[model samples]
Target chain A: MMTLDQDSIHKHSFNITNLEEIPGKKIKHHYGLVSGSVVRSRNIFADWAAGFKSIIGGELPMYTRLLNTTRNEAIQRMIAQAEFMGANAVTNIRFSTSDVAQGAAEIYVYGTAVFVE
Target chain B: MNGLVTAYLQNHELVVGSALLIVGYIVGTLFQRNHLRSIQEREAFFFKLPAVTMKLKSFVPESHWDQIESARMVVGSVVITPDYFRYFLSGIFDVLGGKVKSYESIVDRARREAILRMKESAPMADIIVNTRLQLDTMQPSIPNMPIRPLAVYAYGTAIRLKKSSFPQSSEEAIRFPDQDIIL
Candidate 1:
C-alpha cells in the first residue's frame, strides 16, 4: 500500500496550511506552487444507469463514489509532487474542478511547497 | 400482414418508451425525496461542527484557537448525475434560456455532503479552514445523453483544535446518527 519514500513524505513531515504559516514552524525554502490533477468519467453502464436515475432526481451514489475516488487520486498525486520537490510542507492548498469534455471532468489540486523546521 | 406487422412494431416501441418514461419519473421522484430527507437529517448534525473557510483574511490560528492538529489535508468529494426527469427538465430550461433551478439543489447537497465526509474522515479536525468547493458539470457523453454528471469537491486544512478551551458551548458534543461528532 505504501510507496516507499512517498509514504515517508506523506506520513508526518508534510504539513498543509492555507494560511501563510503553520502554528509553530519556521519555513526555510519556498519552492513555489506544485499541483496534481486527473480527469475521469463513468463507464458506459454507470452512465446509462445514471441517466435513468436523473429522470426522478436524487443523489447518484455511484457517481458519488467515482468522485470520491478521483478526488483522492488527485490529492495523492499532488502530495507526490510535493514529495518529489524535496519539500516538507505545503501551504495555501487549493482544489479546483473543471470540465474537459462530455461526461469527463478534471480535478486539479495545487499548493505552495515549503521546507519547515 | 405486412401492414399489420409494421403497425405492431411501431406500437411496441411507443409502449416501451412511454413505460420507461413513466417509470423513470415515478422512481426518480421517490429517490429525490429520500435523498433530500437524508440530507436534512445529516445537516442537523453536521451544521453543529465548527467548520469554516480561510477564504478571507480573518485567519483563525489553530494553536491560538487551542487546536491540536498534526497538519494534514482532508478532502471529500461527490458526483451526482441528475435523474432522467430533471435531466429532461434542464434540457427544456436550456432551450428556454432560464436558470436551471432543478439542478442547483443537487449541487448544494453534494457540496455539503463532501464537507461532511471530509470532516468524518478527519475526526480530529478542530475546524476545516481554507475550505473550498469546486463544481464541474460534465457534458453529455453522447450528443443527447441523459447522464451529465456533476462532480463537486471540497477540501481544506483539517487541523486539530483544543476543544477544551473554545467558545460555542451550545454546539458542543452533538452526536451524529452514523458517527460520533467529535470535533
Candidate 2:
C-alpha cells in the first residue's frame, strides 16, 4: 500500500534558472524544472465489478467515487510537480485521460517549467 | 355430413396457431425497441463527466494563471476502460449500478507523477503559483469497435517564492535588524 506521502516523489532537472545569481538582485535562488507521472490499475475495479455481477448483476455507483478520487489525485500530482520546480507560478496547465486497455484508464498532467523572477 | 364437418374443424388448428405466432412476434419487437432506448439513455448518463468538467473548467483560471514562489509540473496517466467494462457486465448481477467507479487508479497515477515531477524540480522552493490544469480524451487505433479509449492529461508549472516577498510591512524588517537582509 503506497501511502500519500510515498506518492510525493520528485525528479530533478539539470537545467538551472539563475534568477538569483544576478548582481544587486532583490531576490536570490536557483530555479529548477521537474516532471513525473502517476498510474493506477483498471483490473482492481473490474474484478470488483465482476464479483458483483456474479452475485447480483447491474451497474455500480461505486465507480463514481473511485473515478472522482483518482481525478483529484491527478490534479494534486500536477501541483506537486510545479512545487518541485521551485517556481512561484505555473501556467498553461493541461490534463488528459486515455484507455490503455478494456478495463484500464490513464490520466495525465503536464505544465510548463519556469522560474519566477 | 356431420362427420366431414368435424374433420374440417380439426384441420384448421394450424391456421389458428400461425395467427398467435404473428402476434407474439409483434409484441416482442416492441419490447426490444423499448429496451434499446433505455440502454441509450443509460450510456449517455454514464459517460457524461469528462465533457461536463472540461466545459466548466474553461470558465475558470487555468493551472498556469497563478503566481507563486516555487512550482513544478508533472504528467500522470491511467487506463479506466477495463474497470468500466467489468462494471457494465456486473450490471447483470445487480452488484453495480450505472455508476462504475474505476477511474480512480488512473487519476491517482497521474497525481503521483505530477507530484514527483514537482518535487524533483523545486526541492527548496517555499511555494508554487500560477497553476493550470487541462484534460483531454485519447482514442484507440483499432478500427473494429466504436468504443473509444479515454485519457486525461494534466500539466502545470512549478514556482518558488522568495522569502522577502512575505513581509507585509517594513516594521518587521526594522525590528529584526540583526537579520541579514539580501535585498
Candidate 3:
C-alpha cells in the first residue's frame, strides 16, 4: 500500500476529456472533483487601446486573446493538480468565469479525475 | 424628406444629434448586415461537420472498438463588441425598456461563429463530444462606460473512430472544407 501510494503520487501525462469514459479504455478509479482557477487583469496600455477599440468596433481581438490565454492557463493548472493525484485523465470537464473585481476576472475549470487503463 | 432634414438642421443641438443618429444607423446597419451574411455563408459551407451532444458520450463504445485512437480538444473563439451605432440605439432602447436587437444579433452571430470555427479545427473527426460554449462579458473599469465586448468561446473533444464500415459520402462533401476557410 505504501509503494502503491507513492507510485500514484509520481504522476503521468494528463488528458482532458469531456466524455464520461475514454472510448476503449477501462477506468481504474474515480478521484472525485478537481478544479483550477486563475484571476487576470489587463495593463493600462492595453486598456487604453481597448478603449479606442470600443468606438467604431466589431471585434475586440485583444480581450479575446487575453481571456483565451487566461482560460488555457486555468485548464493547464487543473490538469496539473489532477495529475499529482495519479489521475491519467479528467472527464466531464466544464468551465466557468466570474467577476473578481472591477477589471479582473477569474476562470475556473473543473472535472472528475479518473485513472483509465 | 428634404423639409424634415432642414427643420432638424435649423436647431444646432438637434442637427448634431440628427447627424450622429444618421451616421450611426447607416454604419451600424451596414456592419451588422455584412457580418450576418458572412456567418450564413460559412454555416452552409460547414454543414457537413457533425456536432453532437454530451449525451451521446463517445462516438464508439469500448466494446465496439479495440483502440481509442486520437481524441483532441478543439476551440473556436470570437470577440464581438457593439458599434457606436448600437451604443446609441441601446441608450434609447434602455430608457424605453424594449429589446435591443443590435446586441441580441451581435451575441447570436458570435456564438454561431465560434461553434463553426471549433468544428473547423477537427473537420475529419468522427464526432464532436461534450461541446461547451463560454461567454465572458468584458467592460471597461469606469462605471457606466459604453464599451462592452462579449467573448464567446466554443470547445469540444473531437474523437476519431477507426471503424472501417462507416458509410462514404459524395465528392462534394470532401471538397467543401477547401472553400470554407475561415481566414
Candidate 4:
C-alpha cells in the first residue's frame, strides 16, 4: 500500500506554474518537457458506496478524493523529474486523465522544465 | 379470494418497479433544482473574476503586461452521478436511438460547478487565462451499474495584477452563457 503524503510531497522546493513564463523571471535554459503519470483504482467498499449514491444523483466524494490524490501524486512525480534535470522551475503545466482499463484511471501531467533567474 | 392473491403476487414486480421510479423522479428533481439555484447564486458572486480560454498575451492588452505581479495554477474538479430515474430514461432512449436529454443536463451542471470552484480558489487573482476543461466518465468495478459517474476537471493560470490599475468589472471579461446578460 502506497501512503499518500500529499501535503509533504507538495513541500518540495521548486517553482511550479502553468504559464508560458514565470512572472518576473527570465528563462535561461530549457531542459525540454518533463512528464509523469499514475494509474489508480478504488477498493471494493468505495465502489459499493458510490454505486448506491449514484441512484440518488449526487456528488461522489470518495471517487473525487481518489482522483485528487492520484493527480497530486502524479504532479509530485513530474516535479521530481524536473528536479533531476537540474531545472529550477517548470512552466506550461497541463494535466490529463484517461480510462486505461475497466477499473483503473490514469492521470498524466506534463510541463517544460526551465532554469529561471 | 385465491385468484385475487395470485394476481397480486404475479404483478408484484411491476408495482414495486413503478413505486421506485416515482420515488426516484421526485427526489432527483428536488436535488437538481436546489443545485441549480446554488450555482446561480455563486455565478453572480464570481462574475467579477473572468476566466477565459485565450492566452494571457491576447486576452490582456499589452499595456497591462507590466502590471502582472505573479501567476499560479489553480484547479477545480467534481464528480457527479446520474439519478436512477434519468438512467432509466436514457436506457430506453438508447434503444430508440436519439439524444439522451437527461445526460446532457448532468454534464452541463458538472462543467459549471467545476468552473465555479476554480474561480472560488483564486479570489485574489485578477483573471484566469488559458482555461481548459476535461470531462471523463469514470468506470467503476461494480458490475451491472447502468450509469457511469462523470467527472469534470477545470484548470488555468491565475494571474494577479497590481491593484492600482485593476478594473473591478470589465465588459470584455463577462462572456459566458448569454453574452448580452451583463451583471
Candidate 4 lDDT, B49-157, residue by residue in tens: 8899988888657666666766767777888998888988998998999999888888999999888877765655678889999999999998877679998888888
Model 4 accuracy (lDDT, Cα):
0.79
DockQ-better candidate, 1 vs 2: 1
Q: Report DockQ per prediction, comma-separated.
A: 0.40, 0.10, 0.24, 0.41
Best by lDDT: 4
Cα deviation in Å at residue B33, candidate 1? 1.8
lDDT by residue for model 3 (B1-183), tens: 999978877889877656656665677677778878988887786676666666443456556656545565666677777766778778889899989987788789889978876776555566777788878887667555666778887877777666522233534346544432211
In candidate 4, what are the lDDT values of residues A1-117, reduced to their tens digit? 122223333354577777788766679999999998999988888889988787678788888878778888888899899999999888999888999988899999999999988
State candidate 2's TM-score.
Answer: 0.30
True contacts kept of each: 0.57, 0.03, 0.44, 0.63
Docking class of 3: acceptable
Query: lDDT tens digits, residues A13-94, model 3?
Result: 4566677766667889999999999999876666677665555556666776777677777877888888799888988888
Per-residue error for B67 in candidate 2, Å, reads 15
Lowest summed lDDT over 10 consecutive residues: which window, candidate 3 chain A?
A: A1-10
Decide which is better by TM-score, 3 or 4.
4
TM-score of each: 0.75, 0.30, 0.77, 0.84
Q: Poorest 10 consecutive residues of model 3 chain B by lDDT? A: B174-183
Rank the candidate models, highest DockQ first.
Answer: 4, 1, 3, 2
**TM-score for chain A of every candidate model?**
0.83, 0.49, 0.84, 0.90
